[model samples]
Target: MKFSSIIYVLLVFSFLTMTALSIYYYLQIQQDKVKISQAVSSGTPLPDYHFALIGEELDHDYWRLVGKGAKQNETEYDVFVEYEGPERSNPEEQLKLLDKAIKKKVDGIIVQALNDEFTPLIDLAVGKGIPVITIDTDSPDSLRSAYIGTDNYAAGQLAGKALIEDTGGEAVVGIVTGRFNNTHHSLRVEGFRDVIEQEAGIDIVAIEESNIDRIGAEEKAHNMLTEHKEITALYGTSALDGTGISEAAESLDRQDLYVITFDTLEENLRLLEKGKVDALVEQQPWKMGHQSVKIMTDLINEKQVKKIHHTNSSIVRKQNLPYRQDLRGGRQ
Candidate 1:
């Protein structure tokens, strides 16, 4: 063959080879892009999952709000929320609930721990590849993923500020708490004491524990009031105790005493309306329950969740009582 013709044939062969390779590479890239788009659109790579919550109690309005939030999230995310706890707040019951959830192979667990008894159970859940998150009350020593609840310290501070304002910064205060060891009540008492100590003319005359029970709170409040006749104010760290304190005050006809408590329970709201409890610090139990499930879902899906979520509390008095009817259930 002539040299020029042979060179032209070689050049054509090279051009065809290069064009074929380019087309193959472009098609491969397009295929990869499609796969990624499908994965993103359908969340195909996400794990199938559900979560369970072992709340402190089921019959209480506070826990009901939490369960409502969990159910709302469950519906939104197309996941199951298995909620079960004791009729009353019992650490042993909570542990049994934890065991049941683990046996069911839930994707994750959310706990409203009654006490430190659930620590080992929480650790066991984590060891078995299940993530556990604490809400409302936490077990700090456990291997839980995170805590989602109000800053109890700050809530107490708000309570103290309210008390100070109501009493014009001068009064002997009596404190009613549910449990001495419960983290929420303990932090609240600490914060309240710290703030009250900072202010002049404010003194904590007595601190009483009601075990978060109404009758116990009532008895404790009566004793405190009878013993400390100079007490000018009362503060309760739990919803039940708050109502009990109010009842005790009403029974004594001590209309001059200022009462401040926590949560928006019906009885407490009624007392607020009657000017029995001057102010109540309200926590977002619904938000706690909802966000807890969300965090658990994220953990199960291998997605990121905030290490800590703090829900703020607000002071509810008669002035703002009407607007929060849904939250207070028209208790006032």
Candidate 2:
């Protein structure tokens, strides 16, 4: 063959090989782009549907915060959020709301599980193919999809540790919880007991249930303080009960008693500033609300999520109260 002809043939061969490789790479990139688009658009193969969120009490600040989070999710995800609950924390009323949600055929339901007695109703919702996620409180026996809230037991333990640290673990303590049978309250009591039991010289002399009513909590606190004069500390598990305890302590001039409570209501913050309550355990109610709706959205879409999602709780003492206010914007 001539040298020029040989060189021309080699050049043609190299050009064809490079063109083939380029086409192969382009097709591979196109396929990968399609796969990515499907993953982003389809989102876990679950049904696309609306959700209903039922709380024990919708009028309360905490539940309102939860509703706000759900509303934000609804706007962001283009899903409907039906938020309904009783004016007060009534188990029967909350159950009726749950029934209404089920009848409305929402894709998922979120509840606070007013009390453990709502398990049967929760099971019914699950039986109807509507996934239920409990927030704040839960009924363990219920057929719920998941629970998103703070670890009440651990919160109680944190309060206990704070108390022990403040009093050198030898103070006589009293407890004021919202409802005796409520899961959150019960778990907190258990956690407090566990911590106090492990410590030396710290004793929980009296445990009282306030039913989460301010008047009821006040009465209980008054009676308990009158009866247990040696009590050096008081721990209240609920927002209302915490305020009541603080008020009772202030009224009776029990400045010696160290008060540790939960939630950061406006009044609670005032109490903290006034040196009436030594510390408050703050939970991320806003995050709980946001996550609850997100979980419901995922569940409706058949997306797998963690069975239990826990948010952290922090001890807000007088020293750190200002910092906490800056972080959470001085609101509950």
Poorest 10 consecutive residues by lDDT, candidate 1: 323-332
Candidate 1 TM-score, true structure as reference? 0.82
- TM-score against truth, every candidate: 0.82, 0.82
Off by over 4 Å in 2: 1-48, 326-332
In candidate 2, what are the lDDT values of residues 1-332, reduced to their tens digit? 99999999999999998897567556644764575578579883432556778877877877777787777776666666767788988888777677767766778888888676788888998998989999988777788989999899999999888888888878888899999888899999889889988987987789899988888888899889999998888889988888899789888988888888888766788888889888888887778888888888787778988989998898888788656655355223
List model 1 lDDT by residue over 155-264, tens digit each: 99999998888788999999999899888899899989989999889999899999889999999999999999999999999999888887898899898988889988
- List lDDT for all candidates, in order: 0.84, 0.82
Candidate 2 — which pairs collide? 46-301
Candidate 1, which segments miss by more than 4 Å at Cα?
1-47, 329-332
Instruction: List pairs with backbone clashes in candidate 1.
Output: none
Deviation in Å, model 2, residue 182 alpha carbon: 0.6
- Give all candidate RMSDs, comma-separated: 21.0, 22.8
